[model samples]
Target: MSSNKTNALSRRAFLRNSSLAGGGMIIGFNLLNSCKPKVVAEPTIDLASLDYNDFNAFIKIAENGAVTIFSPNPEIGQGVKTSMPMIIAEELDVAWKDVYVEQGILDTENYTRQVAGGSQSIRHGWDALRETGAKAKHMLVSAAAARWGVDPSECSVSEGVITNAAGETLGYGDVVNEAALLEVPEKVELKKPRDYKIMGKNAGNVDIDKITTGKPLFGLDYKTDGMVYAAVVRPPSFGHKLVSFDDSEARNMPGVIDVVTIGEKVRSLLAEDPSFSSKISSSDKVVVIAKTTWQAFKAKDAIKATWEEETPMESTEQHNKILTDLLDGSKFNTMRSDGNIKKAFAEADQVLERTYESPFLPHNCMEPMNFYANVTSEKVHLVGPIQTPAWKAGLVAKMLGREEKDILLEMTRMGGGFGRRLYGDFVIEAAEISQTINKPVKVVYTREDDMEDGIYRMAIKYRIKAGIKDGKVTAYHLKEAAVNDNMYGLIPNFFPAGAIENYQVDVASYKSNITTGAWRAPYTNFLAFAEQSFFDELAEMMEVDKIQLRLDLLDKVKPEDDERIQYSPDRMKEVIKMAVEKSGWGTKPSNVYQGFVNYYCHNTHVAEVADVEIENGSPVVKKITCVVDCGIVVNPLGAMNQIEGGVIDGVGHSMFGELAFEDGKPTANNFDRYRLIRMKEAPVVETYLMENEYSPTGLGEPTLPPAGGAVANALKAATGNRLYVQPFTKTPELLKVPEKEIIG
Candidate 1:
């Protein structure tokens, strides 16, 4: 039997009271227990007698010691499907050749949180799955050793066989029955880094063969019995409810099932908590569900639903007006205050003031929000791409007024999440539709519906002032206007909470005509962009290197001495020192222009030095040198790929991504007008991960925030012009300003 001990984790020491470790090291919302989960009396399965008849999901095993593993995470070109299995196989102690790989069932039991976003799959799955395989292997070894009347240590396991010192061997399949009868071990010994056979080694994605051969994998490629397509017609404006709809034309369309009106309605008569802000109703609705996606789309165009417009101007104009008003408003909550700010500003030799603005963005995952639900009076089955299946299944059961056990959630491989799939708004929508129709239905949102209806990364404006004395920086004041409540309402006190002296972060709300929700890095995605860029400008005025200025400021704000510091100054210095050394900070080619940015969030530290060159006044990033310390490196290759992808994604958003509105309707719906960074835009990234074996920090979002400002700073360096806006499509020539004459 595998040793049942809780404190024997070999990979890394489990933090007894770590907050992120509470939910079993959340990886893309999967709660993988550091200890093996107690298996409460499961039905026995005889491995030797078991037959592989059907090719379902992605894995299958035979009695002859052939094993197949499946890729559960959707392969949107990120190599998660292959890397995740390496962790499982390492502890299973099976030969790579004997293992067969398969994808997971679109159900919650087979795969918990199967959504691939936030770069969490590998980090979250590392410990839990290794324990699972170790437990299974221990059972097999115990069964064989007991039958041989030999000590378990005397029998070594290799390639699915247990061999004694005398060379007598028995295949794992021979003892499957006895192993199955044993209790599921609570704890199992995990392999150390030195002994890891597959984790650190290079194993390409398991689905590479299938993807190259054009095998059906994605939900777009998924088909079902009597399955029909579906499309929804949502309001053109945000918060729009259907007052009236005439579906006569829709009823006559070809392949039409039925035209249904989906608008906001009271889900429950229960009272909402007046003080609670993080509550989400399971049955919230303001949607349209129809038969075929094409038919629904066509019917939506034909059926005229009366909409009540919220505002007169567009979202951008309204947000800007709100920001301008906030600069004069007094709803400012004093996040932090050190000495007297009024006295500091009055005593300064000169006061420098600047306003920074960042726009709202969309979390455009490759797969549009979709869920397949088969609901009946007996039970409800849900299958689709979702980040948090356990949580989503609870809400789905609540919506259907059934037991939580009745709601079976199957997770399909997501095309991409980037934090979009975590909310599970689409899954609930699909379940409600299935309950209404009393049939197996899959609700699919068109790219337009998905973009326009979904929540957004809130837009923000920052007004900053710094005291400059004799060409030296002294005190700083930052006042911000936040359009939404905290993006991640759970962590309201993230940035500017207790960090920064004389800080006043006023969050003002001007209810917009658009819905807003979590984007990739939540609020930090934009806040870091704005704050890091402003710091760069401040450095230029002080005539000190930007990296040095930040380091000095960080050193002055000690964690113990000052409570207003959000990031650890020591950690920030570590990355900066490493990046500067590796990138040849002071020395560079005459043609290469480099910009530097470093920041910390999500329990991780990252620094980026992006190099660029201006050709014909357009910016072209050549290479990115990144330094990251995320505690531990789970899978070096997987972690590096996430950094590369995140950096590229951030660059794409800063350079050419935005959603424009006309009246209350969205303009950038499809890829034709909404641009994306392709293979050509991807920069060559050289990442250096800190080798200290601390518990892993977040890898998904750390590299993202710095990418935008680094590019912006590099552009300014090449042309001597500061570009202050989202999307460089605006003429770079407009940013040129002649240097002012200095008074002696």
Candidate 2:
């Protein structure tokens, strides 16, 4: 908030002298500002409306004539920190090397849809940015034409220069003063696919240099004058509410600024009484705001608060029982239904059924969730690792009861946001704290807070059944039982909402104390582990080649002809076939085994074949060959990077990563005990892209589902075992059931 920024230095000095004397000097570091366009006026162009002295939207214009575009989408290693800028430079006709890019402070008009989750950053910004760049180019060419008193058609723009047919040239910077006055063209021609100079060529990420050089661009690196640090004390168990708290001890501690109780209350008019907000109780413990992160962390452990305990809910075992019972009773939301499954089962020679379960997962990004907020009575200023700044700005305005224009959300590079940043809860929390304390505050969530307070990927239980006759597929039925509260509610709309014919997906959310939200691939990450594994079982019983069977099914059941499915079964087949040919389907190496799966989500299609070997009953993925088609790739290199990263992240979660909750408390709170896949565990991944002309879709999530399912299916082939449960471990075998085939 602006008021907080105005008051930060004074409040910090007051606290430092009166409260935190013996404490170490509160560091005040100044960070370099991001580059935004500078709007200037000339005789020919009108720059008054375009140039907002306060909103400088462009970056640098070097003496060599290079331009850098700044975007609000935080690059969190998914390559977006650079990929989005590539689109602008490509259209702007600038040398890739000349363009230096930076993540813009979160400002929606200058950088709309600053959120980076769902892999929608590039897809959403592609067309509009292309037009923006093309229009700018056109304006520059027109300015040159006017100077030469020639038709604009005789002038061409290339390499940051506007030149005439006679080869007379002028740098864009020279004409920008005049171009700023010219009317922007309504419709600038877009480059044809073949004529593209920057989109497809595997250009490396523009931000690679910054990241490799250890640049101070991450949220953790953000700082300001007299900025303080704060850590909220969340509930030990998620659901417990703060009934009362004694912060007297915390107040007396050195470096303790103030311990504030934070809780949400719906409008009194909307809710009967603001008794207890329906939202998850963010810990009611005192917030220890101090001059330093270390001091705040140290004082955090010493703070104490009283919680109103609620009835303990079901354990993992009990939750599993409830889901298993739902599947047994054939009770679910019924996502899809087609032919008479009962008659098909009765007519079949053999009916096979299997149940699968996936544990709750945490998105352990390399960095972590963090935000910096400077709030005051008049305005709010925020910067940090946020995916959707526009969305958060709206929420911040509402939460602060301030005009939306008063809030400035600055986007920074994120450590990671695998559907986690979708919830602006933490961002709003930081903004509110800064507003309450009236200071520039950086809120850092300890690894424990990040993991424990994480909106967990829901634990799901699935039951799959198929009718097989003479080893051929006849009929199929799927029953998926999981939480309906959060991400699962969005699955029906995003992924398999309409793709399957005769598919029955039933969803149920069990009331529990643990807070559940979104993870990487949402339900598909877990559901694919179940659905694709079941398909493998169906393949085994039918004595058919796995890849061929899936292809044949796609040919038979085109999604376009079926109203039950949302995706093109034809496109799904394309990727599956592509992966099969590339991975050498049906070929088994002496030392390695292969498994395959194809799934669609986030408007993208991915099919992967994983080669795995059993090492002491644990399936180790040695190599993964994936085929992805998310339509026209704006940047092939960047898209490939996302696919590769998502695959590795998916592999880690499926095979090893899990969050164990004991009485709603996380078991493995840190990376050491949590067991994430490190560099050593990373498999040799070969990724291929299917070319298509359709509008580009997302690449992040689609690549994830296949990694989990493919690895599981490969494990099935290597040992003739099916591990239905997730985090495939050695001790307990989840996929012990017999294999069955699909009946068409």
Cα RMSD to the true fold for all candidates: 8.1, 8.4
- Return the top candidate by lDDT: 2
Off by over 4 Å in 2: 1-64, 109-112, 246-249, 264-279, 329-331, 469-474, 484-501, 559-564, 614-619, 730-744
Please give the lDDT score at residue 715 for candidate 1. Answer: 73
Predicted candidate 1 versus true structure: per-residue lDDT over 20-90, tens digit per residue: 12211111112254363554323245222222112112222244555445545544445666666666667
Span of ten consecutive residues with least summed lDDT in model 2: 24-33
Backbone clashes for every candidate come to 27, 47
Candidate number with greatest TM-score: 2
Query: lDDT per prediction?
Result: 0.63, 0.67
TM-score against truth, every candidate: 0.82, 0.86
Q: Quote the positional error of residue 112 for candidate 2 in Å.
A: 4.1
Error of 1 at 194 (Å): 1.9
Tens-digit per-residue lDDT, 1-744, candidate 2: 000011122222433332222221111101111112332222222222222223323433332354646544676667765666666667778777666664556544434565666767677766766665665677778878999999999988777888898889998766666665565454668776676787777777665555677776678888888899998888777656667766677777788787775554223211442222222354444577988887788778877667766666446777777777766774456555666777778888877799877777777667777788998866788877776677677767766667888886666667777867766557867887787788899888888888877777777787778777666667677676774353363354323333233344456556566666667766577777787888788777777877677776666654555464667777887887788899987777554778888888877888899997655444468899999888888778777778888899889878787777777677878888897777988888899998877778888777887788888888776666778777886324543322321110
